[model samples]
Target: MQFATEILTSFLAIIVPFVGVFLERGCGIDLLINVILCCFGYIPGIIHALYIILKY
Candidate 1:
């Protein structure tokens, strides 16, 4: 589960930024947010991205 969380968070951290930028027009959750998310904890990041994914 930990490994899965790591992979998923990394994947979202990799792809979501560009998509977010494109969709939102130049601004989104910054890179620091991604790094902190992966480092501090994956669950928060996963939850946040999931909400973004599900909601929008």
Candidate 2:
């Protein structure tokens, strides 16, 4: 159930970028990098978010 919620949050994060990660992990360097990646491109941001979501 939690995993499903996380997946949904990750998908929704596509719109705002890194929001799901931030919500999951809170403020940190990883979040900063995600924000930067999001600035570069949406795909990178999504990839990074998935990595973070699955990693820990």
Candidate 3:
């Protein structure tokens, strides 16, 4: 379980910058959405990052 969380944290950390790029490219998503996701839960941030990567 701890390993899983570490993997998730690493994944999200890597994805944050890519998310910024997508947001900058005007993918039609708001930065606040990712910020909110981060605040709410790790899973949301992960999901949001994956979505950004796949979508943009």
Each model's lDDT? 0.47, 0.84, 0.58
lDDT of 1 by residue, 1-56 (tens): 95565456446534653333233233545434544565667666555454444444
The alpha-carbon lDDT assigned to residue 3 of candidate 1 equals: 59
Better of 2 and 3 by lDDT: 2
Stretches off by above 4 angstroms in model 3 are 1-29
Candidate 2: segments with Cα more than 4 A from true spot = none
Which of candidates 1 and 3 is the stronger one according to lDDT? 3
lDDT score of model 2?
Answer: 0.84
- Work out the TM-score per prediction: 0.38, 0.79, 0.48
In terms of lDDT, the poorest run of 10 residues in model 3 is 17-26
Tens digits of per-residue lDDT, candidate 3, 4-49, equal: 6545645644667435424444454555676677778866766766
lDDT per residue as tens, model 2, 1-56: 99798778777677666887898789999899999999999899988888887787
Clashes of 2: 0
Best by TM-score: 2
In candidate 2, which residue pairs get closer than 3 Å at backbone N, Cα or C atoms, i.e. clash?
none
